[model samples]
Target: MSKRVNRVAEQMKKELGDIIFQKVKDPRIGFVTVTDVEVTGDLQNATIFISVLGDDSDKEASLKGLNTAKGFIRAEIGKRIRLRVTPEIEFAFDESIAYGSRIESLLTQVNNESKE
Candidate 1:
């Protein structure tokens, strides 16, 4: 991604996070955090990675809810950002947080075993 696109993506991530937190009324979208945003070179589509704080079911439901509200979210973005084209929004579940936690758990186990 170009520097310009990167900048715009960062701004959109922040703004979208705020918008979801403040505007979205869906209960299924509990504790959703926008992890990252990747915009296509043409600015026609954006993939939004989000981390949800909950179990598997919660995460699944949140993803579904976000996908359902994609159009509304895109419209909201168009309203807030002064972009010539509002990128189509796509929600993706981000498991990096969970992966990190698993790594931490393994490290802790290794340390405990070594301490014996």
Candidate 2:
């Protein structure tokens, strides 16, 4: 990706995150954090990685809701960012938080066992 595209993607990620938090009235989208955005070389597609607060079910529901509102979100992005082509938005659940929690839990368990 070109430097320009990367900069635009970063800006879009911030603006879109704020818009979703303030404008999107979906209860399913709980405490969503936009982790990263990857725009395709052609600028025709963007994959947005998001982390949602809650268990697996909540995260699943949030992803579903975001997917359902893709068009609206895309339109909002188009409105907010003056770009030749508003990239098609793809919502992806970022599981790094969960993975980190799992690792922490394992480490804690090991430490406790060692202390016994």
Candidate 3:
């Protein structure tokens, strides 16, 4: 990604997080943190990675709420940022945190076994 694309993604990440937390009033979207945003080179599309503090059902519900509120979020983004064409956005669950936690636990287990 070029500097322009990177900047846009970062701005989107900030704006989206604010919009979700402040503007969107969805009950299912509780405890959602926008982890990252990935934008295409052309800036026509964006994938928003999010982390929800709950089980699979909560995550899925949060995604559904985001999808349902996509129009409002995009409109908010357009108003917040000056873009020729607002990139269409999609929500995705960020698994890196969970993956890292799993890896850390496994390492700790191995370390304990080795110590014994």
lDDT rank order:
3, 1, 2
Give, for candidate 1, the lowest lDDT window spanning 10 residues.
64-73
Query: Please, what are the lDDT tens digits per residue for candidate 3 over residues 46-97?
Result: 9999999999999999999999999999999999999999999988889999
Query: Residue 95 error for model 1, in Å?
Result: 1.2
TM-score of every candidate relative to the true structure: 0.96, 0.90, 0.97
Tens-digit per-residue lDDT, 1-116, candidate 1: 79989988998999999889998888888899999999999888999999999899999999988887788889999998899999988888888989999999999999999999
Q: What is the C-alpha lDDT of each candidate?
A: 0.91, 0.90, 0.95
User: In model 1, how large is the Cα lDDT of residue 76?
Assistant: 93
Which number leads on lDDT?
Answer: 3
Residue by residue across 1-116, what tens digits does model 2's lDDT show?
79988988998899888888988888888888999999998889999999998878988999988888888899999998989999999988887888999999999999999999
User: Candidate 2 clashing pairs?
Assistant: none
Candidate 1: TM-score? 0.96
Quickly count the clashes in candidate 2.
Answer: 0
Distance from true position, residue 48, model 2, in Å?
Answer: 0.6
Candidate 2, residue 64: Cα displacement in angstroms equals 1.8
Off by over 4 Å in 3: none
The list of candidate 2 runs beyond 4 A from truth reads none
